[model samples]
Every structure is written in structure tokens, then in C-alpha cells.
Target: MKKLLLTAGISALLATSAVAQTIGVSVARFDDNGLTIMRNGMTDHVDTLDGVDLQVEDAQDDVARQLDQINNFVASGVDAIIVNAVDTNATDAMSVAAASAGIPLVYVNRQPINMDTLPDGQAFVASNEVESGTLAAFQMCQDLRAQGKSGGAQAYMLMGQLSNQAAVQRSKDFHDVIGMDMCNFITLIDEQTANWSRDEAQDMMTNWISSGEPFDAVFANNDEMAIGAIQAMKASGLSMEEIVVGGVDATADALVAMQAGELDVTVFQDLAGQGAGSIDTALKLAAGEEVDKTVFIPFKLVTPENVADFLN
Candidate 1:
């Protein structure tokens, strides 16, 4: 009687096996609040799929450490690996290693080049960061132009460090749009690599403001840096309204500031979508399905118009 009952239970579970799949994700760091939210969103989304087993490992923004983490997942024979690269350049070797071991990798949020060319079944998913930068600049330009300034508007950019893709693409987009005008009406007074740290951005902004560069606006590569620049401004007795500031990666604080009119704009990169789509692609590959080579998450300029729709 016991054996018969066990067989019946197994049969019933088989009926639901279509809803069961385990996916392993390696997130970059827990300290980045944006990434944490995205990871949670991924979990919630995967949970709804039924019987989906999701395991996560944190890389802590260390390059070699992340590589080691992926290697461990490979050794454990995870069905698939989702990698949020710490640096755009750190994962090529590991991508090669994983491919050699027959593991599929879906690179998320940050793009890595030529990984698929090495024979690994590779897929990459992330936001369009170039458009992110361009949108921020474009919005700022429009605002400045509308403010009755006949001359070109001046901007100060607190750039992310060279180590990350966010830095690379955001910088390119910011400059590209400005250059589109032949740059006669725009002057970038100064730019510094803040390494995406709020404190560093604060210090840099303080020094720049103290120097009296006469900047009409501040542009930051990420929300953290934008907030830091705001702090520096406040410390220097400048109101948020006095100097227009904008950023990318629509974090909570930035959104609050934007709503309060303390920030000019922020580009919304849907971190949640990037996370879910990346993991979904990885799982599909593990199940013997083809995954797209690239996925682009749309980015939008978050102003008061659409800020309410995205603030949550």
C-alpha cells in the first residue's frame, strides 16, 4: 500500500514538472541597492513560474572573485549561469572556460565581447546605456535652451570610472548628443572619474564647485553620483533648483529628488527587466532551447511626466 501511494504521488508531480526549473544567478554585489532590487524582482518573477528553483551568489564587485564564483557554479554543474560582470573585460577567460565545460552563460546588464565567438553558447541582456546618456543630455539641453539662454549651456559631468561599461557608454552618449549640435552652444567645464561611489562624487563636486567653473548643469553617470553632487551643492549653499542636475539609473533617491524638483532628470534603465530576461534566457538554454544573442532593455528619460509611472 505504501509503494502504491508513493507511485501515485510521483505521477501527480510529473504533471507539474513543466513548471519546475532551477536557475543559478550570480549577481555583482549586494551593496548596490539597485542590483538588489533587480535580483528580488527576478526572484519574484521566477517564483511565479512555479517549481522554479533559483540560487544566487554575490560577486561583491571583485573581478577574480566573480570568475571564481562562476567556476564553482560550473563545477557544481548548475543548469545555467547568469553573470552580471563586475568589469566589462574580466569575464572573457571565464566565458571560455564555461564553454569548454558545456555551460551556457547569459551575461546580464553589462556587455562582454566575442564570448560567443569562442564556441560558448552565449547570450547577453542589458539596458541601452548609450541611449541613456544621450537622453539625459538631450533633456538637459532642451531645458537649458528653453530657459532663454541664447548661448550654449554649460555642463559639468561627474563620470563613472573607466572600469565599467556604464562609464563607457554613458560617457559616449553624453558627448555624442552634445557634439550633434557641433557643440558651439555647449561647454563641458570639467569631468572626473568618480568610480561610481557617492562619497567620491561628493568630494569631486565640492572641488569643482569651489573652483567656480560657472556650470549651468551637472550630469552624472549614475544616480549615486548625482545624489552626491547634490549634497556637494547643498553644502556649498546652492539650491537644487539653482543648478540643474541629471543622471542615469533611476534609483529611489534620484526619483524622489526628481519629484521634489531637486533633480532635473534621470534615465530609467529597467534593472528588473534585465535581471528577469537574463535568467529566463539562461534557463531556456539549459532546457535545450536557443537563446537570442543580444537583448536590449529600453531606457527612458524620467522626468515629472513619466516619473510617477516609474517612481515605484
Candidate 2:
């Protein structure tokens, strides 16, 4: 009787272990501010679910590395794969790999060039880029008016990588909003890509400062570039009172700057929401459940007055 009981117990334990699911996550780069926050969210969600294992890999902003990681995941027979693509244009290879393996692919944070090309079991989760730029522009105009310098406020734009969709959409939307008669008082003095890097943005700002041109505001597509611009301005003996600086992502450093009156404005992208939503959708797909092709979280404006709400 004792031998029979031991055999039955072993069989049940093996059955339970076999039912556990495994998920694979590939990030564009773990060092990115927003992507780091998203990764935390993914980890938190995975911890809450029983019998679900998460395998995470970072592509370090390399397309080849991202593809290699995806291939490995496919070979491992993971139930689903999530990717924060390094380059939106290079998603075709990723999609083919996941689809060929009959696994669901969920793209988070950075969106692909064409959503329609995603296979039936694929999906995307991100906040709209347009809202970030539009809100920043609106806030800039408002701050300018409050300072009693409404008309003809000179502005400089610090762009991210031109190839990135978030950078493209944010730049376009800012221009569109500024083109409206309500914001026509603002004039763009110059624009250049900083490649979404703090050091690069600082170098660009240093050059612009050396040019001796006067600008009322500096708008960066992301917080890192904005913070870089601010550092440059500070080193050049320019104060926040002389120039309004704004950016997206509402990153922790940016929030601190806002509180200290160093940053003028920022647009808050829901990083946590995007992260959790991606994992939830991926898990559902893994379980053979249906999910929407895309999930969009909204962006909000964050200024000094409302910065505290987002700090924690």
C-alpha cells in the first residue's frame, strides 16, 4: 500500500509541474528610462501569477541581437513572446519567427511600422505619441502666457532618433499644435535630433548655446534629452527663468526637476500600465484566449502644480 501511494504522489507532482506556462520577454534596451519602468511592471505581474515563468532578455538596441533572442525563445518552445523592438521597421523578421513557431507575439512600448502585418496571434500595447507632443506644446504656450511673454516666443526642438515612431509622431504633433492660431505666438528657432541620448543632447545644446542665439523654450521628445538640455543651459549660466524646458516620459529625474523648478513641463506616458497590459495580453494569448490586436494607454500632462501626483 505504501509503495502504491508513493507512485501516485509522484505522478500528481509531475502532472502539476508539466502544466506550468513559460513566457519570454525581449526588451529593446534595459537602460532606457521608460523601458526600465515597463520591465518592472512585467516582473511584478509575473510574480502574481502561479505556474508562470518569465524569461527576459535585452537586445541592447541591436536588431540582430533581438532576432537572435527571439529565435532562441522559439526554439525553447515558450508559449508566448513579448518584444520591445529595437527598431520598429525590423519587426517583420520577429513576426515571422514567432508565427512560424505558432507562438503569440506581443510588442510593447515601441510600435512596429505596420500593425496589419502582425500575425493573427500578435498584439501591441503602448501610449499614443501624439498626445505627448500636443500636451507639451499646450503647456509651453500656457507657461509663456503666464510669464507675460505671449507672442513670438522663440523655441528650439530636441528630437529623438528620427527613425523612431514616437519621435516622429511627437515632433509632428508639436508642430501641428503650434501651427494652430492659439499657439501661433510661438516660433521654432531650430530643430535637431539628439538620438534620444543625454550626452548627445548636452553636446547639441552646448553648440546651440555657443551660437549665441536666444530661444524662449526647449522641447525634447523624451526626458533624457530634456534633462541633458537643462544641464547644458545650467552650465552656460542660463536659468530656468530664462528658458522653459519640457519633455515626455515623466521620468523620476524629470519629476524631481519639476519639483525644484528646473523643468517647466512634461507629458506622462503610462509606462506601468503599458507594461502590465502587455503581460496580461501575452498570458491570455498563451492560454489560447483571444485578445485585442492593440491596447492604448492615454498620456497626461505633468507640470509643477501636478507633478506631486506622479512622483511616487
Candidate 3:
């Protein structure tokens, strides 16, 4: 009977070992709030899987460092690889390395530049850039009109990292919206790249304020920049009601800002959902299963009326 019991235990151990799969993940940076939530989502999802393991590394916003991490993952024989690109334009090397090694590669959050030419067993999982900026900008436009600024309004834009695809696309989205006849009353005073840093955005806004450019609105590529601009504006004694502030990525802090009547509009990018979806796609590709080349999680518009829905 003891021998039979030992045999059963050995079989269980073998079964667990056979099902184990390791995924290597490289994130653009660990300091960003949005990326932090997405990374946590990946780890939390791994907890629910029986025998899956995730090895995550931070690239610290360096393109070369991110590529080296991918190479190391490949050398280590990880079952699959996930990358949150530091620079969307510099992802071709990463794709090539993974494809040459016949390992599945999945990009999360940031859209890769060589997306159309990606080798088989590769996919991208993230919220659509078109929707993220459009939702936020359109909401801001409407808010401006409601505040009796339909006649004329000037605004400043805060851009994220120029190398990021999301930043470029989102900036285009804002321009597209304001060009429409219905929203044309809004004019852009100036736009500057804050590189998605709160402190940098605060400084930029302060400089704009010093120029005495009477602006009615501020558009930011992300919530961090929006909050930074708010801080600068408030410090300069500009009332929240005087300007319409809009941003993308309805992070926890952004939501709190909206609740406090500081942020006028924001778009929910479902960053955590993208993280979970990337893991699922990577596992599928690793197992030789089929998946869409691009998997897009939808973006949602957030405003004071419905901000409570996302606070949790």
C-alpha cells in the first residue's frame, strides 16, 4: 500500500512539471503608474493559472536594455516572451530575435512599429490608440461648448514620449477632433512633449502660464501629465472651473481628480485588461495555437457623471 501511495505522489509531481510553462516579460519602465498596474495584472493573472510562471524584467526606459533583456530571455529558453516596448519605433530587432529563435513574442501596451511584418506566432495586445485620444478630446470639446466657449477657445496640449506610437497617434486624434467644423472653435495655442512625466508637465504648464496665453483648456496624452498641469494651474491661482482638462488613461489618481472636479474628461484604456490579454495570447502562441495578429481591448470615456463606476 505504501508503494502504491508513493507511485501516486510521483505521478502528481510529474503531471505538475509537465504542465509548467515559463513566460518572460520585459516592461518599458516600472516607474510609470499605468505600467505598474499592468504589470500587477500580469502577476495576478499568473496566480490564477495552475502551473504558469512569469519572469518579469524592467527595461528602465532604455531601448538597448529592453533588447538585451529579450535576448537573455531567448537564451534562457523561456517558453514565450512579452514586451512592453520602450520605443515603439525600435521593436524590429526584438521581433527578429524572437522569430529567429522560433519563440512566440507578444507586445503589450505599446504598439510595435513592425506590426504588419511580424513573423508568425506573434501578436499585439493593447487598447486602440484611435479611441483613447478621440474619447478624451471629444468629451473635452463638448465640455467647452457647455461652458459657453463654443465661440472661441484656446488650449495647450501635453504630448507623451515622441518615440511612442500611442503618443503620436493620440496627438493626431486630438488634432483630428479639433479640425472638425463642430469643434473648430477650439484653437491650439501650443503643444509640447512632456515625455509623460508629471514634473516635466508641471514645468511646461508653468512656462505656458508665464507667457500670459489665456487658454481655456488643456489636453494631455496621459493622466499623469494632466494631473501635473492641474497642479501648476492651481498653484498659479487658476480655478478648475475656468478650464476644461482632459487626458487619457483613467488611472486611480486621474479618477480621483475627476471626482474632485479638477479633471474634466479622461479615457479608460483598460491597461490591466491589456496585460491579462497579452499573457493569454503569449500562452496560446507558445502552445502552437492560433490568435489574432492584433488583439484590441476597447477604451471607455470617463466623466464626472460616470466616474464613480471606475473608482474601484
Candidate 4:
């Protein structure tokens, strides 16, 4: 009887030791196409791990709600947490909450404002913003020159949500690229934010079309907005061949647009890779292992010539 009791106790201890590590994830919103792919990647990758559990929540694009989720994760004693921030500038409180609780935190896809000041066991995982818009705009510049627009060309800009770091950097990238001598012939006629909404972008594009501006190109911060602009131009009876359209995030819909000869250029930001990397980083951090504070997945330029290679 004594031996049996000892054996039972050992088995119980082994079972306890095999308990899965839990990770709490708070995404900015679940309805976003690109972010949905990322969130799916996280869930799929976790499924492959031996002892891991993921608890995902949508912050619904609310800063206060995202902070509350972080606090809740801490209170629940999760081993680690991953956040796809709604407002990149509003992440200081989230970082502090995770740090105070001694839990590992990883910021995925979106950059946090306090990145440079992130405490121990915290990191950011995403593609480099500098590369995203620069690639698209530079490619657009080249495509315009190829089409004999080198003499001079006027273009409109469609920006993403202003609060997100990616949007700010991507917008800056477009301006910087256009400022270069090689691309200086391109003129930016007007710029506006669509708040990363397709419907808003379509409405904004329709308004621009109503202005009867003879723009040569449209540079958008992301594929959804680019698609929106395309839809608006089509509705206005503007030929796709007449204007060069460029955007970041070579999404499936964007690739379809490229195949249909509508979208001219885009930059491929690996949504899945960023998602998986965040999980790996979070797991490492949870285990008290050293990891880079920032992990960047490289961005690739996509055009009609090689768009097929990027198709789903």
C-alpha cells in the first residue's frame, strides 16, 4: 500500500509538471482581413506545440478596452501575453501592467510607442515599416516612369489610421521616396486618412474624384484602402490603365486586383510570420530566455510581374 501511494503521488506530480503554458492574446480587432490572417496563424502555430494554450480576445479598436484586457491578463496570472495594439501611441500603460506583474509581453504586427523603453521580458514583432511603403512608392515611381510619366505626374495619397505607428512611418516613407531626385518628378496633390477602413477610403476617393482632379497615381497605405480607391475610380468610369495604384500589404484581394490589372504595386508584409514569431518570442520570454527586443520580418515588393508568386 505504501509503495502504491508513493507511485500515485509521483504520477500526480508528473501530470502537474506537464500542464500547458497559457498565453493571453489581445488583438486590435478581429474583423480586419490582414489581422485575421495573423490571428489565425497564432492559433494554428499554437496547435502544433506540445504544451501551449492560447486565449485570444478582440479589443475592438478601443485603447481603454485593450488596457483593461492587459490588466485582466495579469490578474488571471497568464504566463505571457501578446498584443496587437489598437493605438500604437497608447501602449505605455499596457507595457507597465505586464512588467509590473513579471509576465512576458510581446507586441505583434503593430509597434508600441514605448518600444525603446520596453522593460525586461517584452518585445515587438513585425515587418519593418520603412520597407513597407518605401517599396510600394518606389515601385510606383518606376512604373510611372516606365509609362512615360517621368516628365511630371500628380498623385493622391490615402493614409491609414493616424494613431498607428505603421501608418505614420508608411506615410513618411511615401513622402521621403517622392522627395528623392529619382522620383521627384511625382507630385503629391492631396493626402488624407481613411482610418484604415475600406468604406471610408471609397468615400474619400469618391470625394477626390468629384473634385475632377486629373491625378496620375494613387498611393495608399494598405491594400484595403487601395482596393477602395480602385472601386471608386471604376465607378467613376476611370480606366484602370490610366492610373498607377500602389499600396502596402499584398493581401489576397490586392493580388486579385493586380491580376485584373488594377493595382500596380504593393509590399508584402508577412502577417503569418509576424504572428508566429510573436508566439515564439512570448514562449521564450516566459521561459526566462533571452530574445531580441525587436524582431523584424522583411518586406517584399510585389508587382504584376511576380504577383502570381505571392498568391494564396
Top candidate by lDDT: 3
CA lDDT of every candidate: 0.82, 0.90, 0.96, 0.94
RMSD of 1: 2.2
Query: lDDT per residue, candidate 3, 33-134, as tens digits?
Result: 999999998998889998899999999999999999999999999999999999999999999999999999999999999999999999999999999999
Clashing pairs in 1: 152-185
If both were scored by lDDT, which would come out higher, candidate 1 or candidate 2? 2
Best-to-worst TM-score order: 3, 4, 2, 1
Clashes in each model (backbone N, CA, C under 3 Å)?
1, 0, 0, 0
Q: Could you give candidate 1's per-residue lDDT for residues 1-312 as a string of tens digits?
A: 999999999988897775566666778787886788788778878877766787798888888888888888888877778888788877778788679788888888877755456354778888877788989988877777767553867888888868778788898888887787543477888888998888999999999988887778898999999999998998998877767788988888889988888888899888898888987788787777876788898998898788998855
Backbone clashes counted, model 2: 0
Candidate 2 to truth, TM? 0.96
TM-score result, candidate 3: 0.97
TM-score of each: 0.92, 0.96, 0.97, 0.97
Better of 1 and 4 by lDDT: 4
**How far does residue 91 in candidate 2 sit from its true spot (Å)?**
0.7
Give candidates' CA RMSD values in order: 2.2, 1.4, 1.3, 1.5
Candidate 2 local accuracy as lDDT?
Answer: 0.90
